[model samples]
Target: MGFFNMLLSLAAKGAVILFFLLLLAFLGYCLYIKRIHMKYDHIPGPPRHSFFLGHSPTFLQVMKEGKIIHDKFREWSEEYGPVYRTNVLHFVFICVTCPEATKEILMSPKYPKDKFLYKRLFNLFGQRFLGNGLVTAVDHDLWYKQRRIMDPAFSSLYLRGLMGTFNERAEKLMNKLSDIADSGTEAKMLHLVNCVTLDVIAKIAFGVDLDLLTNKSPFPEAIETCLKGMVFYIRDTLFEFNPKNRPFINEVKEACRLLRTTGARWIQDRKTAMQNGEDVPKDILTQIIKAASKEENMSKEDDEFMLDNFVTFFIAGQETTANQLGFCIMELARHPEILEKAKKEVDDVIGMKQEITYDDLGQLIYLSQVLKEVLRIYPTAPGTSRDVVEDMVIDGIHVPGGCTAFFSSYVTGRMEKFFKDPLTFDPERFHPDAPKPYYCYFPFALGPRSCLGQNFAQMEAKVVMAKLIQRFDFTLLPGETFEVLDTGTLRPKSGVLCSVRHRKYSK
Candidate 1:
């Protein structure tokens, strides 16, 4: 009885000690958060919702209300001026929309991509997504090495060579759309364009012919699932932990696995072909493999890196261009006058031309302006961020070091100060005679880290869009607003639904 009493006493003492230890840890964490708040308190932002949550609650509210988060950022910019601070829990972001800040942060190599943000992209639902890929690589030397190797694939000569593939893939889309046009069925322009871009990237970048428009494929759905997952996963820190989100999180993991496994199989096939001395096209996959071949002995990490580039190219190479094309079509359909004007230009430039040549793309000047305006209004990629490692004065605002600098083309592009009557979808904003936007317009982003596939993407977009306008007259289906969906990348909420009729001249 005496020994039993002693044991109970000792157990009670241990419980007390554990409680005190936890209390100290919690207190320490609170102090750290307080210090961070104090550090950036001088910066302007909306009032915090709570001591612990910071602006997270407000952000969640915006998401819950089904509004594009960047639009909210633009509103905050209007209220607080161009440079302001926003916090989500302990993470702080300095939003900069002015031209000077944009030029300094993006033009200079001094600011690298934020590791905090990009590293989150390195995985999705516990599956490796873009691990150490060119897009997610935060290391300067590592990214530079990969960039140098891949530059040849995106060079002018290489892109010019890809026009045939671009036209072929886009022609397939035209055929599919023609079928729908005959049936008088409303077509989802976003899905159709997505298939075309997917096919183009598969053929030109990886030397695979998915022919997604002709054949049903899981790739399109998988890409959509992964993109949707990315938005939720990256924004909400506790998203994966929620019991209700488990199903979606599982689907995301499976989608990621599908992409990576497909990449693995394709990569292995290329390796076997190379070993057997079979002829293979020099493509982005070739560059990806070559980027690693220089190493004496390839490691598992190196292999994963190759797959990373595979997934990155497949997603990044296709999604933005597809989204842009969808938006362009939607805008053209809205303004009949603009549609007629653009169609006339396409007729003049590419009339009865089944195969659009590289030279033809350059001659479609008005079409180019329309495409540029689409990007300005709806940059599918939306924004880029940088890690500010040193304190600097941006537009005379003293920003502290160790904060993220966010530059959103979507926010700046819509601001009235940057573009006159920014809400108006004016293609003339990109007219040849108009003065170029100074440091304010960057749909493909700007600087060394700017999209390497910008030219490739635009070339594909022009071909598909010009052909679309040349062959068919489309009208937007009624009852859908011009709402944008932000699923990692921005896309039309209504999928750019349109009814098409074949033009007599083309027939």
Candidate 2:
């Protein structure tokens, strides 16, 4: 009985020790968070909702309310000036909407992409998605090398050569839309544009013929699922743990696998073709393989990097352009006057022409303005972020180092300070006589790391848009709100549903 009592007493003492240890750890964590909070105390921002979670709860509330997170940033920008700080958990993000700050941050290579953010993009739902691709590569040297290798494929001369492919793919879309128009059926313009862009990227970049408009392919759905998964995975830290999210998460993983596997098969085919001395187009895929061919035998890591670029080009090349076209259509449909003017321009420049040439693209000046205005309003790839490793003063406000600096075109483009009547969609803002927006307008982003496919995307977009306006007259279906959906990239929330009718001059 004495020994039993002693054992109980010892166990009680051990429990007390463990409890104290946990208490000490908690106290230490609180002190660390306090230090971080003190570090950014000078920057103006909304009040934190939680001592530990920082602004994360507020962000969650915004998401729950079905609003784009960037719109919240814009709201905060209005309240707290152009440059303000936001805390997501313990991480500090200095949101800069002013043109001066935008120029300083984006135009220089000194600020690399935020590793914290890009690393999250390296995988989605624990599946490798963009593993060290040109987009996700944080290392400047690595990105530069890959960019150099891929530059030839995007050269002005090379892109000029791709006009034929663009016309061919876009013509397929017209065929599909014609079917919808004939039956008087409503069409999802976003889906149709997505297929055309997918077909274009497959043909021009990888030299594959997906013919997505003609063939029902899993790729479109897979791409959509992966994009949706990317939003959930990147925004919510605990996304994978929730039982409710399991089914969607599984689909995301499967979608990622499909893209990577497809990339692998296509890559192997190209390599085999090269081995057999068969003629293969000198395309982006060829450059991707060349980028990783420094070693006699490619390592597993090299092979994965090749796949990373394959997925990156496919998603980035296809998704952003399609979203832009969808939003452009949405806006044009909303304003019949603007649609009429744009159609007139297309009719004059590309009348009765089966093919839209590179020279013809340059002559579509008003249409170019319309497309530019669309991006200003709905920058499909909304923003870019940089890691601020050194302290600096932005707009005379002291911003501390060791924070992420985010430059959003969406916020800046809509600000009253940057553009008059920011909410009004005015194509005249991009007129040749209008003074150019300093650094406030970057739909394709600005700087050394600007989208490599900016011209390619725009060229493809103009062809599709010109043909679309020339051939069909479309009206937004009733009940469409034209809300922007932020699924990684911005897209029309209602899928840009529209009813189409063949124009009198279509033939």
Candidate 2, residues 466-488, lDDT tens digits: the string is: 99999999999999997988887
Question: Lowest-lDDT window of 10 residues in candidate 2?
Answer: 289-298
TM-score of each: 0.96, 0.94
Best by TM-score: 1
Worst 10 residues of 1 by lDDT: 288-297
The residue-by-residue lDDT of candidate 1 on 1-507, one tens digit each, is 999999999999999999999999999989988999999989898888877778877777888898899999999999998899988767789999889889989998899999878999999988999999889999997788778767877889878888888888888898998999999898988888888889889988789988887698989889999998998877777788899999999999999999999999999999889879899888878766766687555688778877898999999999999999989998999898988999888889888879999999999998899999998899999999999999999877899999999999999999999999998999999899999998888988899999998999999999999888889988888896799988889999999888899988634
Model 2, position 58: C-alpha lDDT score: 78
Candidate 1 segments whose C-alpha is farther than 4 A from its true place: 1-11, 295-298
> How much is 185 displaced in model 2, in angstroms?
1.4
The global C-alpha lDDT for each of the candidates, from Candidate 1 onward, is 0.89, 0.90
List of clashing residue pairs for candidate 1: none
